[model samples]
Target: MTRLDAVVVGAGPNGLSAAITLARAGLRVQVLESHAQVGGGLSSATLTLPGFVHDYGSAIHPLAAASPAFRTWPLHAFGLDWVQPDAPVVHPLDGGRSVTLERDLYATADGLGADGPAWIRLMKPLLDDWEGLLDDILRPLPRVPGHLLTLARFGIRGLPPADLLGRTLFRTPEARALWAGLAAHSILPLSTPGTSAMTLVLALLAHAVGWPFPRGGAQSLADALRAYLEFLGGEVITGVSVRDARDLPDARVVLVDSSPRVLLDILGERAPTAYREALTSYRYGPGIQKFDYALDGPVPWADSRVGRAATVHVGGTLEEVTASEAHLDSAVSDRPYVLTAQHSLFDPTRAPAGKHTFWAYAHVPGGSAVDVRPQVEAQLERFAPGFRDRVLACTVTTAPQLQAFSPVFHGGDVNGGRGDLWGLLSRPVPTATPYRTPVRSVYLCSSATPPGGGIHGMSGHHAALAALKDLFGVRRGE
Candidate 1:
């Protein structure tokens, strides 16, 4: 093959984004992926039976829809249609009661009982500056922020521990539990600082962008992105794993959209001593065991609204969620807090006629082999009775399985690395420039970079921009 201007290792959203960005810069760019198909985490398959499409990783996409980078590309033209539900999220309590995170702020707050006003008061500022806040926080932070006031407001009120936020702002268990469940997405302990930021960002997005996913499966979104990249003259090579630096093309610029450790492994001796030590010592949070269920019918949720919403948090009260998520020392909970999404309810293409698709995941110790299915079933049956009887088929993915499937998923720490207190600001290693590695003309564009996890792909976009300005002559605005 001819030498390319840029070679992006890994074809996840971040890799695709880097390749696409470089391609848009009028450079010859090639993306190499290990799997036959692209879209590392975004890929989907019929893990159960034919005709049932399930998302392999990301089920709900609020960050992707609102991303500054994705907004520039019209992915919808390439068969990416987002199906938004009536409510973005719903947290179920006992006795047929559930709280929905409606598109309208008041509508969501209204269900919080006595803490309804407090919920609104806490979220209103972030919602008011939703776009600005995302623009600042979506990428690396502590830079000269454009919206310093908005960032300041969010940081002051949103940086507390999940347990603290829940207890202080919410008078009712329902409201507090909802916050706890959303914050648990961080995979950090509830007592961990900066955990509350997840709740604030996710909650605001429910109203700001409306939590939605592609109609067919998450893979459809990836396909659309890849198609867009190809349209821009970028090339993607599949089934080619780049383990050593010798596997990469002789390119002017190289971007690795993998974990920091994987980048170190691929480049090895090429990376300097300091950078090598930093990446090797990188910390990861608890792993997640994801379950995809092909259901005979919709989940028989006690509260019908739980099925109506796109995502559901199945953990009980705030205290209960805290106890379940405190598995930092690598313990799995029998009554683990679980997040579930019944995609077929909103997007029928996910399953066959009358049949349904259920996606759920629970936190466990990194690389644990214990089966969390019984716990998952118990959680589902806790809110939705007789849930097991409706299952036509199910597939379980442990941390090791996810890691084997995609190297970037390091120990199934899906956020690339932990986004806890210290790890949040200084992920992949403490440096003002997270994307720029020790090696010149090489960058880390994966979630291991700044802004940590999610499907936003901003890390790739930013990394490509850095490569363009620092290596090439091209540049973009601040």
Candidate 2:
């Protein structure tokens, strides 16, 4: 029986995005989610203690602030408010000395001393048309961008390896280390080709719009999206996993907010052999060993700025950061690079009064069950003395556990898939619209698509538009 016009098989940000789009276009949309709650990566819970709340998947949301798709939605009106820290990021060195990426471009430069001029010159052009620049970079490639020169200039800088660019452009260790920390977000080694693109865009995001988190945890953002969909007469069913398209209610179109692996399973024999092989051959990157801490007091950081920064890069200098990434590339290292966010420092709702919540993760070899907490804690303790003593309680989520929780984080590859040089452009498969799969009415709408990962929701938004234009003949606006 035809129960809905469309069915979204995952209620992650991407799934909800596609559901909302179709609902707004006057189609009956129903989202079926495996998890009990909505937000796929946006869910937050009291992981450590009764008072402490930690994000299960993503923590900081720089991409959300600049997403063209989110810009069109009135999510803020639906009770999604952002809370910003004093600074976007803090990179601490050996001693108490630290470098901060401030919200204001000039303020961030001021901390760089002599390299301030070079920083200003490098960032000025990008900041001028920040939104336009994001528009060009934050979507499927192969299409003509509105701003050709802006994208070309970005390509010139972003195309280079971050290691080379940092060494060539900046003289100081602080500048180079900051870039390394930012580029490490790519999950690729700093020496890799597209690594510079990750660093440039992340730094620009910090200087353009401060890295912020949703108030009352990321669930608020997901709830807001779900609420907006409901207002548009859409619905979602929880705890229902769609193992195959045949298992789902009859619908005109089905958008899967899942990884290529899950898509392969769902399609089964219905999938074309080439598409099945392509999805099967789709590469997943290194996994993550995550930790959440409930602290008795603020982390005793050597640098006071670390208290103000919502996100902290715990690895030491440029050379050290590069070495740590290389270690992840080959094997787990004792001194691993750690990406941390202490939102409870800025957002009070994350925990009870006095207690604080801290989220951190280190990249580990794919499908590795090894617990990297000791090393992660060691790294934190390296920068923040007395860090181990301050923890009231701690919770660890192994790579296997992450994959078990969400299939999209297959093998604990959180950013969807491997984002190497080719991983960025030809993610999953290279097509004008990466959303379309062999099954015409069935579209893949996950971070596995172009503009991979983080809480941007563009992959879902783009997939929905593609389905509308091609399948339903309805342009996104209409």
Candidate 3:
């Protein structure tokens, strides 16, 4: 029975970030994870064929590189290289046409036709003040940062991605459809407020820092964090799942990198009645089905622009994406809004010299066990003719399997809990300290908390700060 100052359950990015922070603050910490490996959804592997590595979960890092916490940590000093591709994303339209968002804002604007000026106007201010804006949006909620004024100015009277792009800069169908493609990254309905924000933020990031992936793979990002934690004298225990409070070790602090339901189940009667009830009432948005393929070569898109991007959004039009999302809103699976990332283009190490690896997935009704590989492949085939021939082999992970790997991704809700306005506010619950829980000295640091879902790891960093302040009389190291 080894006692430690803190025990973080789950060794995902958030969990590792928390443990590393705590250890740097001179505390003894131990992390426990149910999976045999660390990194959770960010893990990488050679699944289908030898020498062809696949990102088991997330592939790109627009937010991770943009994270203040990640920047301050100096992960690059630990051999983690952030690889940037030529273009962040490419949206292929109905014809043999495509829209590409380059790292240069002016170049991207020039490609949008009549709406070009509006595109520049909307993004210029945000891009210029990105650091200040990010400080507000990514800061721990309930504590407004000094940049709140700037943040609110940008957020208020906002147009959603579809409408914003449609009315302002893009009269052309291709241009509007292009912005809609970026907006679909949120997986939210087209008209939603935060949906537009997500699109703009990602677009701004494309110009500011560009979307980057690790040189070795995304797993390298996780491995680097884990290494830092252990270097600071923290430890991780893999294959150990905590189902109840008794299953955990006694410590001055405990942070769960899991969903609300998992926390409720672990605490049982120990949790406050209200908190438990709120956990049960938690609303998870529609889920998704993911596919990882070992490809023989690049996807044969008619428009060569598709080959330049790290990722591609495969929904047809703004109205089509909205209609499909609306169907999912009503518990319909929708034809799977395909989000595909081709890492092989940038990292030749991901596959054989001439071959490539493909990662793709689509949204479905929550808890639906439908295998959507056929539908997704057919959709890809529409853009890239003979796409079926590119596949040497593939593996499809249903929603349940995804959930099994990361219970936090409940019902395969990839955006963590939910991204909608209501779900974003009340999810896991509304509280002054959203990360703190009923049990003393315990916290929730997973994406289920504020700054919901991404590889950013801010939730973990925030939760650790709270634990430091509450349990150990410390703050964020002035």
Candidate 4:
């Protein structure tokens, strides 16, 4: 009977973050992962081919660089390396013209021409207050103290009449396209309220700290975190799936980094009726299908700007992106919006010499079994005419296949659950403490909680603090 002060049953970024926090706080912590390895989305492997290590889910780490949690964690000293590419992203328009966002704000703004000043004005404030803004964005609804001030700044500058920010940001079509390109990262419709805020935050960080990838791969990040946890006397057990509380060792607290469905399926009657209803009533967002490609060389884009960027937003203009997103939710889009990342340009170690590794994915209806490769390739070719010829080998994961990989992605809803305004508010479920469940010591610390999705590990860290203080009377700084 190996009892522990805390046990986190999921070794994803959130789980490991939670475990590390608890262990550092003088608690005997242990992390249990269902998979053979850690870093749920951050895991890396030779998926496409040998000598080419591809990220399992997320590749880029803009949030990691900007996150207060990461800044305090000092992960770099633990063997993590950050690499910033020359260009952040390239958005291709018609007439063989494209816009590229670079590490310098002035450079990106200049590329947009007429909308240049507008881009700078809209992003400068948020960039200046990146840390303050992140605190408000990452915390739960009621816990955020500066929501009013933050919302006012965003509304006054970022939002437009009828309270829409995405559309009213830029007057020029190309500028609007650039804004849309940034906003699409949220995986929500451009009309949404928080969508614009998400856009400004990510864009600001792009220039503030720039998007960084670990030296080897995202797995290096996971491995570093895991190693630190062990250094503090914490333990990690992999390939051990917990279906019920009985499967876990006795502990003062238990945090689950999995989805509500996984918890409900196992805990069943043990879960309070109210929480279960909330989880059951939860609406999932659009599904996702992604392609991991191993190429002999980079994706040759007609516009030279495309080659300079590490990322490429494939959807055309504001209207085009909105229409495609709308069509995706409705399950029919001849031209879907796609997000592509060319990791090879930043880190040559991802592939063999003169070779590259590419990742692209599109949103679709939930539980959709669509192949999505043709649509994905077509969208890529829209920006890069001869993109198909660059493919050496590829692996396509359908929505169901992705869900099978990580049940946390229920129905392939990568944002954990629906990311709409209502969904964001009621994420996983609406509660004062979304991380705390009715199952006594058990808590939900995955992206399913407040500040849903993205690489930020606040959800786990916040949940751990609550569990420690509430469950074990372990006060911070005591």
- What Cα-based lDDT does every candidate model obtain? 0.87, 0.87, 0.82, 0.81
lDDT of 2 by residue, 291-334 (tens): 99999988899988788898999898888888888856458778
**TM-score per candidate:** 0.98, 0.98, 0.96, 0.95
RMSD of 3: 1.8
Model 1 lDDT per residue over 1-478, tens place = 7878999999999999989899988999999998888899988889898999988998899999999998779898988898999888899999999877788989888877788899888888888888988999986765788888889988887789989978988888788888888888888889988888888899889989899988888998899989999999999999998988888889998899988878997778988898788888998877889999999999999988787787999899889889988865578777898988889998888898999999999988887868889988998899999999998989999999999988788888899888886887788877777888888888999998878899998999988988998998898863
Per-residue lDDT of model 4, residues 1-478, tens digit only:
7778998989988899889889988999989898889998888989889999898888888887776677788688789888788877778887688877778889888888888998888777766666777777777777635646665676465433211565566778787777787777767666666666667767877888887778888999898899988999999999998988778898888898988877776566988888788888777888888889999788877787677767788888877887777655667467878888898887899999999999888888888887778877887887787888988999888788889999888777788887767777887777888888888888889888878888878788888988988987777631
Q: What are the clashing pairs of model 3?
A: 115-169
Order the candidates by lDDT, highest first. 1, 2, 3, 4
Off by over 4 Å in 1: none
lDDT of 4 at 316: 88
Model 1 TM-score relative to the real fold:
0.98
Candidate 3 TM-score, C-alpha based: 0.96
